[model samples]
Target chain A: MKSHTYTLRVEFGDCDPAQIVWFPNFFRWVDAASRHFFVQCGLPDWKTTERERGILGTPLADTQAKFLRPASYGDVLQIESHVSEWRRRSFVMKHQIRRADVVLVEITEVRVFARRKGDGSDPHAIESVAVPEDWRAMCE
Target chain B: MKSHTYTLRVEFGDCDPAQIVWFPNFFRWVDAASRHFFVQCGLPDWKTTERERGILGTPLADTQAKFLRPASYGDVLQIESHVSEWRRRSFVMKHQIRRADVVLVEITEVRVFARRKGDGSDPHAIESVAVPEDWRAMCE
Candidate 1:
């Protein structure tokens, strides 16, 4: 199982009036970590893929997250992410947000390889594509 | 059931390289919508509640969100939020994110009214408080 770790510093703007890191900020960091994992696994930029293969990017189909502990601004957090499962057209990515040895949040996301609909159809329409074997090999 | 709506304009920084509003930004808006619901229902700010009753803001325990459509910068989105269920120590909030009549995302969150542990214990420790009758009445 290959894993990538993304580190971030919680800034003042990331916290709410309660002085704790706002929950949505955690999602932002996790989303960034998801992309970083792919980059580290040798995947090209999404722009390149969209231009070459019409593969826009991985778009999340479903996501569930649990907050186990609260973090405050100025804290340093690390997100450890890895692909936990791979299906025909979708995959699950798991992320554990931790401060030192204490786990703060956990997230699991199901995402698909998306491509814009062609054939003179709706410009905003997108559909899922099968998992590319070469991308999977590179990730693994 | 009483519901409150909050509207916001998507800003440039809220979008990603794809020129679409990033997924996490929707969570941010929904979080703000959750707070706005309480405010619209005539509840005081978290600061007031914390000072008077030792009740911090509601903290999310779990959340599930589905992205039905993508949004972009400059788009105006509205979120309709309301309390769908109330339990002893937790409650569920449902948020519908829309651009006019088109729903862009749906989110359901389980959150708890939290208070700091006062047992001369760890400062960061927090525990859920039973749903306050007065507060529930205000929301309803």
Candidate 2:
């Protein structure tokens, strides 16, 4: 229900010729912040999991992002994400992108389906399954 | 069956602490390439629609990326995207991540739904909607 926020600086590639953050790159910042949250909560990032167990998973389903202000290259930004809702079917995570403490973008990503263990044909239907106990134990 | 590719130099922020390209960043790169495709087709990126016309929509389905190699900072990479399938109800986009001629990732995005504008209560459904004439008319 609350958030974990992290800070990162916008690099040159994160911006465009206009010297502002490229629109699509917002997802990168959100994903990086989300990864930080997962690691902090004990879920290994994809790379770590692949190295240790040869398994990986990522968000599937839907997403929406709204840009409120322009972020320039070299700006120090803060990203925050929290479990906004948890249902038997799925969970919702909300993220906010800000520059120098000013809000820049608001995002909500709904991750429902996940595939693991290098399987392409079969997807683990998380909606029909219960949240892993570890998820509840960490961000609670 | 053809692709429109975009070239960009990798930056540290695009990688993980291990100095390899992060998974989510691959999605960002493909999206940037998609915008490039739109430009080539004579359409403005969606941000222009959102900011200039208030006609905003976003993908509401799933996107998946398969990572084949590590991409590091200072490496100039190319992302290729093309319409692999355009059916009556939905479409599919295929993406390739490459460094010079070496392929690094292959991705496909299937959009099941879309959030559209000008509806009274909720966003409009997007099943079977036609790709705009100008956009589709571009290679004609």
Candidate 3:
């Protein structure tokens, strides 16, 4: 029921040659918003979780986004993110990018709580784990 | 039917605190791969197209990605991108992120050839235009 809003200012580097905010930059902001939602809900950092239970962080399994309007440099956008669902080993995060009263983009992502396959040395080896009850409780 | 492969070496900044390639960075690479596909196909940059026909760039209308494996700094990735379909005002691009022969991620995007609206002054005013025949020919 609770949501977190992350504010960001579009920078020159964030735009493309067309002088509009590149679409990928929206994803960057969304990823940050996802993390901010958990942090705002008082969950421990990923490092602490990894140390305690081998949970590295939330990695996306599936992601979809729709772009409605264009944004350019100097624009300030707010991304509101919240948890929409929690599965056995995954959760869905929903984000809406807005400027004032206008919604510019919408995104929904399915992410899993992952852990290192071995000792975390092999960068490519990681697997998802069951949803942590404490994490779910804190987020919800 | 021709596909373009964009090779990139993952950098330190491209990763997140978890020391893995951030999901957003994948989108960034995908954007570049999209442009690279056009350039490799002999089309001019977006600026030229904008000046010639009010075509700014291919802006994403919808995108979906599935992450199959994780990548980290110092890894090398090759994104093979090609236009899979050409619609009236939009096109679909398919991209596969690979390392050597291993598939790391897959993404498909619906993008439009967009132009500035209302004399190009208002940053938020932009809309998709019909796919240019010349542009499509070059890409195909």
Q: Can you tell me which runs of candidate 3 are displaced by over 4 Å?
A: none
- lDDT string for model 3 (A1-140, tens) is 88999999999999877888988789888988998898899988898988988887899998999998888898889999999999999999999999888999999999999988876688788899999898899888
Clashing pairs in 1: none
Docking quality band of candidate 2, CAPRI definitions: incorrect
Root mean square deviation (Cα) for candidate 2: 10.4
On lDDT, who's better, 1 or 2? 1
What are the runs in model 1 whose C-alpha is more than 4 Å off? A119-123, B118-123
Q: Considering the true interface contacts (CA pairs under 8 Å between chains A and B), give the fraction that model 1 also has.
A: 0.64
Model 1 lDDT tens row, B13-48: 987766678788888888889989999989898989
Report lDDT (Cα) of residue A52, candidate 2.
64
Shift in Å, residue A69, candidate 3: 0.4
Look at candidate 2 and give me any clashing residue pairs: none
Please report, as a residue range, the 10-residue window in candidate 2 chain B with the lowest summed lDDT.
Answer: B120-129
> What proportion of true contacts does candidate 3 retain?
0.91
Who wins the lDDT comparison?
Answer: 3
